[model samples]
Target: MIDAINRKIIAALQQNARISYAELGKKVHLSAPAVAERIRKLESAGIITGYSVKVDLDKLGYPILAMVQCKVYRAKEREFKALLLSYDEVIECINVTGEQAFLVKLAVESLSQLDAILEAFIDLSDTNTMMILSTPVDRALPETFIK
Candidate 1:
């Protein structure tokens, strides 16, 4: 049950969630209090989650970004999962099919740092590494068509 008003409010928020209630009210043709009420409802309904800023890892001194495909050897699944969770550099880890058991995307400061990180995986059978050159397209969810 997506109401037209809610859709418009969502679109506006998606554009800039930090917009003032008065400004949002003007755009949505409602009072500031009305806008606040609508936003509260949206938040309470779990439609609007917490906001986050997208960070540039390279500029922050983490210049190395690589997708390391790993094949866990002679391992129990519990230990493997714990090991993955213990590392801070590992932004994303997944168990997959094909030649590798897991693929890990890492953000590291340097090759030495990456090597240090990979040292933890000494027990792993083999790992295929591919360094990311450039991000051609980092797409966000489509909100323009919601209205």
Candidate 2:
């Protein structure tokens, strides 16, 4: 089980992953080497998977944000899954419970590009697309602690 200090380390990482081990030590009340060792152990145990940078897709010229629900035919699902995986515009895709087999999040430049991407899946799956106007709650990982 994770101790209290490890939880604090995780909280500190969530705030800013770019922080140096020496800087992180100050926040968690530990020495630089101690912090580094803890981080290594966390990674080895798979408690700390990896680090990432949060980016603004809109600022990067992808103005169109869409959530596409795809109800796929089981017989042709292999091709459908592979096709979606190949598209750069399709940023996120996950198997879902309700009416749809997969929920795909897309970031694209225009409606034409979105249409073209969807056309390829038409034969294998029935897709419902919803364009995102504004994201009041942008993408964030599930937070277990904050400190």
Candidate 3:
């Protein structure tokens, strides 16, 4: 179970992942070595998975964000997963319930590219697509829950 001090450490990391151990120690009122040990423990326990750099997909020439809900044939699930994983445009693919089997978020440069991608899967799956207007609430887990 996470204790109060550990919660503080997690909170600090969430705000700024690049913060040095010494800086985090100062925020959480622990020594740098103590903070380092706690972070290592968190990583070992699988609470802290990994760090990633946030990028601007639009600036990188991938302005189009599309969400695809695919009603995939049950037997073809494995093949479909492999196909989705291989696609460079697929940023996230989730196994979902209801009529849809897979929900995928993809980035592309143009409508033609999006059309080509969906057409590739239409032979084996019933797919629906929606364009993302904006990411209004993109965030990590709120620190209050850990506290």
Best by lDDT: 3
* Residue-pair clashes per candidate: 0, 0, 0
Candidate 1 lDDT, 1-147, residue by residue in tens: 246777777877776778898998888799999888988887887877766667899999899999998877765556766877888899998889976888999999899988887887766547788998989987545655553
Give every collision pair in model 1: none
The CA lDDT of each predicted structure is 0.80, 0.87, 0.91
Candidate 2 lDDT over residue span 1-147, tens digit each:
477788888878887899999999998899999999999999998889999998888899998999999999878878988998899998899998887979999999989999998898798889999988887885434345422
**How does model 3 score by TM-score?**
0.96
TM-score: the better of candidates 1 and 2: 2
Q: Against the true structure, what is every candidate's RMSD?
A: 3.1, 2.1, 1.0
Give the per-residue lDDT digits (tens) of candidate 3, residues 1-147: 599899988878887899999999998899999999999999999999998889999999999999999999878888888889788999999887798978999999999999999998886689999999999998877777885
For model 3, state the Cα shift of residue 82 in Å: 0.7
Clashing pairs in 3: none
TM-score of each: 0.73, 0.91, 0.96
Give per-residue lDDT, candidate 2, residue 126: 93
